[model samples]
Target: MLYDYPEYYETAFSFRNIEEESRFLTKCINRFSKIDVKNVFEIACGNAPHAGLLQEMGYSYHGLDINRNMLDYAAYLWKDLPNKVNLHEASMVDFKYPIKQDFAYVMLGSLYLNDFDEIVSHFNSMSNLLNSGGLYFLDWCIQFGDPLAHNNNNRFVIEKDGIEVESEFNIKLLDQEQQMYEEVWTIKINDRGRRKQFNMVERNKAILPDQFLRFIKERDDFEFIGWWKDWNLDNPIEDENNVTRPIALIRKR
Candidate 1:
């Protein structure tokens, strides 16, 4: 799988502006967070992309990922930082952490629950780790449009450090009633003339805007803040058709 090769995978998705994203996250904490965020946790964190950056800002960093290679690479990548980062090998749904987190986030819609029951369990676990007034930020995790109509974003190419990586993403409905989807990702990499290909498949449970609101309403530990577009607080999700890069935040009660 592409995730096994940390260098190639980071290069493939390096288009992300980490500095801008880190700044936005800090702004969110300043603008919306009710408590002083001392430490941050990342779910399904790959390569710990924001580890060093967030650490530099004085917040301790912690991340969890199921992939061993990703965790190993993240440890090595941030090993020399002044404040050491905590890396854990576990699934996001029910991972256990003794330390309480002030802010937690997951990027790129990596929430892969199989059903509503799992979703509930995931939230339950999250509630255990986050203290009151903590915030949970989700990016591209809510479905506001037809996944099948996202053909324009299915194919992309990226180049970094003499390595060209091409990625193709396709989604197929697995079950209509359950809102389950099968995502197929094909990655082609050329590392200084060494060509290789990798394929990965994952199943995800899509959480719609209304459904997510209702889900949080049914729970007592969390309160839905709101969902936005393009990472801008001013650009609230007004129209489903124009929902590009949806971002949602929920605060612990």
Candidate 2:
């Protein structure tokens, strides 16, 4: 959708916007008993549009993102709210808060990266932050087939105030031995006949559904609770790659 647009993302979240973000967070909050949810933490919180949403639900939640610019924007937006939402600019790989949380969330495919070993290491690290039987909600992209075997490319263009921003997604085959795949993204921001483009990409060492299940099984502290292939709250069943993305619900045992 308009999520790729830097301008739109600078102000608010994409698609569901603030209202839908509120509803989603509220649903997550309700999952636990009312006595257990005084503090909430969200990793890779982006602009923290969801912070305002959490505040409305009576949670004094904290948001963390790696980017300083996005954190500044979040602080500015939530300055007037009655309940203060904390924002931290730090990498999820090494973030440690003073207080342990009853539940944590890392939205979208933010945790997936090029390194399979590192991904598991990162997941293992989160276990220490969780309370007994604490929940960790994660969402990730699922590769149905061999990701390196297929090439998919798409382009998204957005125009705002005479400025045209174009994001081109180009898939490059890396290593098929481990189903490794990389997509290079080039974003061109043009205005008044002048243009500047930013090139960024994610190289994911792909893991299929079965592989993910096996990996989770090896973890001693977390138990697989539920998996939703699509974001739909009602129907949780769908094939890989065909689904929007998967939301993984885990509990510490």
Q: Pick the TM-score winner.
A: 1
Q: Looking at candidate 2, what is the lDDT of residue 228?
A: 70
The TM-score of candidate 2 is 0.81
Candidate 1: lDDT of 123?
94
Compared with the true structure, what per-residue lDDT tens digits does model 2 show for residues 193-248?
Answer: 88676677777676677777777788788777666754545656555454555666
Off by over 4 Å in 2: 1-13, 16-18, 29-35, 141-153, 159-164, 190-194, 238-241
What is the number of residue pairs that collide in model 1?
Answer: 0
Best by lDDT: 1
Summarize candidate 1's per-residue lDDT along 1-253 as a digit string, tens digits: 7788999989988999999999889989998899999989999998999999899998999999999999999999998999889999998878789899999999999897888888988899899989899999999999998887775668999999999999998989999998899998899999999999998999999898889999999999999998889889898897676376799999999
Give the TM-scores of the predictions, in the order they appear: 0.98, 0.81
Residue 241 error, candidate 2, Å: 4.2
Error of 1 at 129 (Å): 0.5
Off by over 4 Å in 1: none
